[model samples]
Target: MKRTFLLFTMLTTPSVSLADNAVNVVSWGGAYSQAQDDAFNTAFEAQTGISVNMVDADDPAVPLQAQILAGNVTTDVASLGYSDATRLCDENMLMLIDPATLRPAPDGTAAVDDFLPGGLSDCFVATDVYSTIIAYDESKFPENPPDSLADFFDTEGYPGRRGVLKEPRFTLEMALMADGVPAAQVYEILSTPEGLDRAFAKLDTIKDDAIFWEAGAQPPQLLVDGEVVMTQAYNGRIFNAAVDDGKPLKVIWDGQIYEMDGWVIPKDAPNPDDALAYVTFSTDAQALADFAMQISYGPPRKSAASLVGNYKDTDIPMTPNLPTTAQNMANALAFDNDFWVDNLAQLNERFAAWLAS
Candidate 1:
C-alpha cells in the first residue's frame, strides 16, 4: 500500500533534523500512551534518530495551557480532546497546523478530505476516535447481565455501586441517554435547561451509590476490587483489562459517547520543527492503523480503516472493538464538542454543586 510504502521510505530516509534530538509529548497515560509509544514514538525515534519523551497527564490540555501561560513551554506536542483542541486553537494557545502538511492516503486522498468529520482542524489532526462505555464485571452479573444504558441507571434491578467519571461531559450525556433521550438529540436536549434538569434527576437515581473516578484507569480497578459492579470507562481501558489482563469485564456499547482525540503543538514549543515532524509522521494513515491495532480506538483516517486488522499479538479482529464499528455505533453518540466547548465551565460548576449536595 502507498501508506506503508510512505512509512518505509520515511523510516529509511530520516528527513527530520536531529539538532534538537528529542520531542516531549504529553498525553493521557496507560494503554493509550503505550499504544502511541509502540506505534509512533518508538518508530519515530528509529526513523529520525531523535529521542521521544512521554509525559503523563489526566488531561494534556491543562498542562499544555499552563506551560504556554507560564512562558516556559517545555512540551513539544500534546494529545487533546476535540473540544480542548478547538478551544485552545481559538484562544491562540496552540500553534497553527496546516492540514496540507499531513501525509495523504495511499490512494492519494488529501489529508483534509480523508480525515473523518471533526478530525482535521486548524490546529488539530485527529489520530483516533474512542468512546466512553459502560463495562460490567461478568462475575458480578452472571444471572442477568446489564445490557443497556438504562440498565446502568436501574439501581434496584441491578443494585450495586455504579462507577461514574468525575466530570459533567460524559456523565450528563449518559444520564440523559439512560433517561430515554435519542443519541442524535442528546446535545440538543443538553443545551436546554429542562434537559439539564432531567439528566441530573436521572443521575439522582444512583448518585448516592455512585463511585466517581477521575482517571481512565480507575474504572477497571474499581471493578476488580469489587467496589463497583459496573462503570463508565474509556472503551480502550476495558479492552486492555479483559484482553491484556484477563479481567472478567464486558463492554456495554449502547449509548456510548464517542469523540476524537489527536495531536496539538503548544504555541511556543521547544522544538517546533521537530514537533511538526513527529506529528506529521505519527498521524499518517499507517501510523494511525498501527496504533489502532495496539488498542481498540478507531483510527480517524478513512484509509487507515482498511489498513486496520487484528489486535496486536492477538487474533481478535480490531474492527469489532472500535467505537466506529457499525454495531457499536448504532446507538452511540458522537460526543458534541461544540456543546462542551460552550458549556463546559457552567456544567462543571453545576456538577460540583450537585456532588456536594
Candidate 2:
C-alpha cells in the first residue's frame, strides 16, 4: 500500500482534541461514510496523529454552501458531488485545490496525469465514482423484477411504492430515461424547456406512488421494511445491503447515473492545514483503493484500479461491481455537471412546486 508523507504535528491517538487541532469532514452518511471512516479516517488519524471529526449530511454541499454564505464556515472539509464542487468553486465559496499538491501514483506519475477525467478539478479531488441505481428487494418481485428505468415508473406493473430521491437532479435525469430518452441525449433534451416539462410529466406518472428519501441510507431500509418494493439509491448503499447486511436486494444497472464524489475545503475553514492534509492523504492511490474495496464505487485514480483487489474482508472482486465497469456502463448516463450547475436552482424551484401540486 502507498502512503503519502505529510509534514504535520501528530498525536498518538484520536481523542476529542481541540477544535483547531482536528479536521472536520462532512459527508453523506450510511455505508458510504462508514467506508470512509474505516478506510480513510482511521488510517488518516493513525498516520498524522490529528483527530478527525466526521459528520453526516444528507448532501454535504447544501450545508457547506449555507455555512459559507452565512460567513460562519465551521466545516473544514466536505465530500461533494462534482457539480456542486464546480458550482461552489465558481461562486468562490471553496478554496482552490492545486492538483500538483495531491499525492501521485506509486510509480511517480503526476497526480494531474493519474486521476481520471473530471477527477481533479480546481476545487475537488475525487475519491470515488458512485452511481445512482434502481435496486429492489428480490422477494417483492419473485416472478418478474424491474430491470429498467421504465419499470420503476410503471406503478401498475411493479405494483408497489417506488423510492424517489427528494432532490431534482437524479430524479429529472431518470425521468427522461424512463420516458425513452437516450442516455447520450438526456442533457441535450434537458437543456430545453420542453424536455424539462416532458421529464416532469413522466415523473407525474409515479408521483402518487413515489415514496421520497433524502438520506443515502433510507432506500435500502425502505426496501427491507417493505415500504418501497423498488427504489432509486446510491449503488454502494444497495451493495452494502446485499453483501454486508445479507439482504436479498438486487441492483439494476440498466439506467444507472454515475458521478464523482470528492473532497473540498471551505474557503474559510477553521483548520485549513489539517483539512488539506486529510484531503491529500484520503485521495491518494492507496486510500482511494481502500475506500472502493469497502464500497462498490470506483476509485478515481488509474493507479488505484490495480491496487483494488476485493471487497474488504470478502473474496468478492470490486471491479465487476464498479459503475465504470463495461457491463454497468452499457446503458449508463454520466451525470451532467455543467447542465446541473447552470439550472439547479430554477429546476429545484419547479420541482418544489410540482411536489406541492
Candidate 3:
C-alpha cells in the first residue's frame, strides 16, 4: 500500500516540468482512483516519460464540462460513464478517439476487435465494466440479508433506510426492476412516459425511506456509518470496502445494473497530443487487465480476461467478484447506454423536480 501511494505521488506530483509534459487526469477517487493509479498512471509515465497529474471529482464530466465551456480546459483526460462520454461527445465537448490509434491485445487482435461489443464509441475509449448493485453491511441483517432489488424498495420488509444514488440512471432502472419488471424488459418499459412514471411511482413507495446519495463513494460510507441498511453502490467500491477495509459489506448481484466507464479527452484539452498518448497506453489490453487486479471491474477487452488475477493483496480471485462474472451476472441488467443518452435530460429534469417536491 505504501508502495502504491508513493508511486502515485511520484507520478502525479506537479513538478515545474509537469504542465509541459504531464497529462492531467480527473477520476472518481478512493479505491477506484487508486486502481487507475496502479493500472495506468505509473506504467504510462514509466513507459512514455509523460508525467500525470491526478484530480478527483464526484463525476469527472461535471468539472470537465465546466472546463470546456469556460474555454479554459485544463484536464487532458477525464474518466466518465458511457452516457456522459457520449453526451459530451455529442455536444462536441470531447475529442474524437480513433480506435486505430490504440494498442491492441498482445495476441495480435486489433484493439477494436478485442474490445467488447458497444465498448467503442467515436469519442470515448472504454476502460472497465462496473456495476451498481445492492450492497448491505452484514451486521444489520446477519440472520437474513437483503438479496434482490425488491428488497431495496421494500422498506417495510427490510425495515431500514436504503441509500441510493440521487441520479436517475441506476436509481430509476432499479426501481422499475424492484416493481417486478424483468431485467431484459427494463429499458423497453422505461421508454414510455407511463413506464417512467411507474418507475418513479414505485420509488414513491419508498421515498420517505430512501437515503439518497450523490457521489459514487457515499453508499459504502453510508453503510459503514449505519445510515442505510442496504444501498445501491458501485460493485467495485463495495468489494474494496468489504475486502480491504473489512467492513462486512456484502453485495447482492440480483438485478445488478452494469455498464462501462471510459476515458475521454475534453475538447480543446491543454495537452491533446499527450492526452491521446496516455489513453493509448492506459486502455490497451494489458493495461486494462492490470487495472482489474486493483479493482473488481471487468476489462473491456475480451482477451484481457486471460491476464486478470486476484485482487490487490488478497487471494480472492477478481473474476467472480466482477459484475461480468457469470455467477454474478445471472440476473444483471445491461444498463442501456443509448436509452440514458437519449432520455437523460428529460428524465433527470423529472427526477429533480420529484426530489425537490
Candidate 4:
C-alpha cells in the first residue's frame, strides 16, 4: 500500500516542550484543513497550551493505519471517515473513545444526545457531515445541464467523459442509485449478489467514457480543464473551485451520499490526554459551527446547524450548500458506515477484479 506523507507544521507559539506540551493532529489538506486549523487547532492551543503540529494527507486513514501497524504512533489524533474508524476500532488499531469525556452542548445536553445519530462510536467522535455530489462544468451545459444521477450516467445525452472517484465506496452507491435503486434501500439491495451485479452492470454503461480520479482535487480540475463534462466530487472542493477559483460549475444534489468525518486517537498516542481535550473542544456546537463558516461542510451537531448561515468573506448562505440541509436531504443517502464496514473488503476485492477484467 502507498503511504501519504504528511509534510507540514505549525509553530504559532515558540515555547513547546517535546515531552508534554505538544500533540500531532492529521487531516486532509486544502480548504478543509484550513477550516479545521481556523476552527479548532489555534483555539485549542490557546485554551490548553498544548502546541498542535498539523499534518496533512490525501486520506488520514492511510498513514494512520501505517503508524498503528508499524508500532510508532506519531499522530496523537487523526480525523477519519466513519467506516475507517469502526473497522480500525474492531481491529484494536484505535483507542476507544468515551463520549462521557466530551463537553456537552451549551444548552446542557449530554454529548451523546447532542451529536447526530450514529455520530458517536466506540473509537471516534464525528466533526462534520460532507457529501459526494455530482457536479458539471456550467459552460458545457448552459442550455441542458445534468440534473440527476441518471443524467450523469447518460453520456449519449450529456456527451462527454464522466469523472468518478477510483474507489468502490461512492462509485458503487452511485451506480446503484443511477440504476433506480431508492436511497433507503441501497444497502439492503447491495447485500445480495444479484444487487452487486446490478450495480456493476449499471456502471458498465459509462465504463468506457469514464475518467477515474484518485484525489479530491482532481474532479473539479478535470471539469475546469475540459477533461470531463460531469464528475462526482466533494461539495466543498467543487464549491471552492466555483466560488474561489471562478470555475463555472453547477452541483446536482440528487442522489448525493453524505458521511461523517471525525476525530480518533491512536491506542498508543504520546499525548492521549491532550488529544481527548482537543477533540472534545473541537466538536462542541460553536466550534463545529465555526468550522462550517470557513468551509461548506455541515456541522454534525443540531445546535451547530442553526449557527451556520453565511460563509466567511461571502454573503452566500451556507445552508443550501450543506448536505444535511432539508432540501438536499430529500433524495440523499446517509452513507451506511456499518454496511461498508462489513462488506468493504469483499466488495473491494470484486471491484478490483472487475476493473482489471
The reply for model 3, stretches above 4 Å from the true place, is 1-22, 55-59, 62-74, 153-159, 204-209, 215-217, 225-227, 267-271, 337-357
State every prediction's TM-score relative to the real structure.
0.83, 0.77, 0.80, 0.85
Candidate 2, position 256, lDDT: 95
lDDT of 2 at 344: 92
Which candidate has the top score in TM-score? Answer: 4
lDDT of 1: 0.86
lDDT of 1 by residue, 82-137 (tens): 88898899999988999989999999989999988889889998989989999999
lDDT of 2 by residue, 76-162 (tens): 898898878888898989999998889989999999999878898889999899899999899988897788888999989889999
In model 1, where do residues sit more than 4 Å from their true spots?
1-22, 45-59, 70-74, 268-271
Tens-place lDDT per residue, model 4, 44-150, is: 87877777777887678888887777777778889998988988898999888888888888889888898888789999899999999999998997786778999
Show where candidate 4 strays beyond 4 Å.
1-21, 57-59, 62-74, 341-357
Total residue pair clashes for candidate 3: 0
- Residue by residue across 1-357, what tens digits does model 3's lDDT show? 112221222222222223677788888777778889888887788888888877777667777787677676677888898888988889988888889998978988888898877689999888999888999988988787888888888887789888878989989999888899989899999999889889999989888988888887899999999988998898878987888888999989999988898899987778899999999999888899899998889988888887888887778888878876678878888878778768999889999999998
Q: Candidate 2, which segments miss by more than 4 Å at Cα?
A: 1-34, 41-76, 106-109, 154-159, 204-209, 212-215, 267-277, 349-357
RMSD of each: 6.5, 5.8, 4.6, 5.0
lDDT of 3: 0.84
Error of 3 at 169 (Å): 3.2
Give the C-alpha miss distance for residue 208 in model 2, angstroms.
Answer: 5.0
Least accurate 10 contiguous residues by lDDT in model 1: 1-10
